[model samples]
Target: MSLTRVLWFAGVIITLAMGIRHSFGLFLEPLSAGGGRETIAFAFAILNLLWGAAQPFAGAWADRAGARRVLVAGALAYAAGLWTLAVPGMPLLGSVMIGIGLAGTTYGVVFGVVGKLAPPHRRSQAMGLTAAAGSLGQFLLLPAGQWGIDHLGASPTLLVFAALTLLIVPLAWPLRVEGIERPSQPVGDAFREAMRHPGFLLLSASYFVCGFQVSFVGVHLPAFLADRGLSSSVGALSLALIGLANIVGTWLFGHMGARHDKSRLLSGIYACRALAIVLFVLLPVTPASAIAFSAAIGFLWLGTVPLTNGIIAGIFGVHYLSMLGGLVFFAHQLGSFFGIWLGGRVYDSTGSYDPVWWASVVLGVMAALLCLPIRERPLQRAEAGA
Candidate 1:
């Protein structure tokens, strides 16, 4: 009953967090009225970068202090950030706060609670369910966000979103699980241990690709579709399709992770992503094709989150899962920073997304290869005399 309640509330929190996040792309054109695209993109870049940088600390804090505290604080930060963002000339400050909020509210911290609540056998599925909830949010909110932009306009929509994020504070209460014990290992020791592990490093590097690929798509795909003369609705639909398909993909991968070798599954996912991007880019542009591409790419979207976090838990144990996961996620955010900033810079300079598209394909393939070599087995601490 406790686990079920935690998962339920966690899912709702993720749904709100991810849903609002996925809508940022929809605001680009509308927000463009106030400034150049790069300025907005740079703000998002800062958000991703800061989110990544803060994740380890947030995760560590959650590991020490409990997710409820971290999550409530994050929720407040997120709401405040959105309110700030709605103000003109405050994108940087707003993004910084939002980034910090994301570090606490999203998978890095949430998954730690899930990992602790679910047994080893069910961990992957629990994480998957949470991720799917996030996807569902994306599915539901993308179109809603577009509608808000079309009707209420960007600033008002941001304010509304800010108000909605406050819900996370209330939702976070159910996540407080009492009597769970922590391992004796110092947090610093765990960090050093993971940093020394080759598999952990490789996983972090590959996750960087995931961040780069998805962040670019999330922030830039709407504008890309517009460049192809498609309507904003089509762009909204494409993003929603990705979210819809991800519901299945994340769940399927999460189920598969329990029974299969997670590293291989990750490899296959990245490979599929590369292929999907290639097809999406090479095919002639149409609403149908765009939707098709969205489904294909979206199915592959966040599957990595469950599988990657699952691998971390499997190898290192859940005691430090949040912090370790945060370390890996930080690498992903770094990629997101480049992906978003570079896309805008390239577009502003060359007026094309081709370079970034090709870059994604290449990165995807590399990530696929990188995952092939990870050692997913838990560390033999006793054997190593640690």
Candidate 2:
């Protein structure tokens, strides 16, 4: 198959995988009722942590074994995880399994595949397209899950997700290829080299804020809206609008990353996030305004994924793309842990989401500043030789 077809196929599968994984947040209330908030939180936290931690190993395995097999296994695991969710008292185990499934299936694997397929000049755009597709999944699936919950209830909703996950198998077929030989860099040395790079560290750090903001909002926004006496549908719509807006945003940023300075664009994106949060908090809490905020913020959402992945490809090489991206993603998930857990903690203590909202704004501004000093150029000539 042509590279374009390969990318398109990868994009579809990755998006669906990510979308389905993300929709797990919709199960928060139901799972919490079955267990407790702590149980649900712990389950999801375990998922996020495992997802983050497993990335490097998954990436390394993909690098050695080829993305196709890893992706296939991931899809199967994803389905199994969803099936586990259908069983009573299984959220924690289900989440960990789901994390493993997602770690192998989504951006870390797909972006690595794109890095190998796409020419250096086109890598940014390819990453953008992939990220945009994931946003599209979020747009399409979150509401569908909500509708299923309203009409069919939670168990059936998850079964539907499991069925959707089976689509990944066919998608993985195109991705199967013989493994390519890589330069003989020791794994430890490669990781150490990446860790020492200032740009990589900045990229990882800035991504933490993205995780925190997204996780906190994704997990808590519905509850917050309900607290304000809005219908559950409004909350669902708000999340969907954000997902929809991200489609446009991811596409735009992808194009921009190819032509503009990625670090500067990243800085601008974070700055916009800070402003958006301020407006969201300052504005009156209403369904219309909330939806508007969701759309605006969504445009900025996941815009970082492509640029960040592109930066890794640009600085390192496609050979290590998955490993490096996974490391960065690990940082992102760490932030997600704190964001979701802390949002709940703060709300429980204060009975309002105001503090969490303001914290996100502050973190956004800080991340914007952190991104400014990133060196977007390739590594030193001697280092490249090494």
Please, what are the lDDT tens digits per residue for candidate 2 over residues 227-311?
8999888888888888889999998998899999999999999999999889988888998889889999999999999999998
Candidate 1 per-residue lDDT, tens place, 1-386, comes to 38888889999999999999999988877777755689899999999999999999999999998999999999999999999999988889999999999998999999999999899999999999999999999999888898998898899999999999999988888787577787778888899999999999999999999999999999999999999999989999999999999999999999999999999999999999999999989999899999899998889999999999999999999999999999999999999999999999999999999999999999999999999999778886754244
Off by over 4 Å in 2: 34-36, 176-181, 381-386
- Assess each prediction's global lDDT (C-alpha) against the native: 0.93, 0.84
How does candidate 1 score on lDDT? 0.93
Model 2, C-alpha of 126: deviation from truth (Å): 0.6
Q: Model 2 Cα displacement at 190 (Å)?
A: 1.0
**Highest TM-score model number:** 1
Alpha-carbon error at 230 in model 1, in Å? 0.4
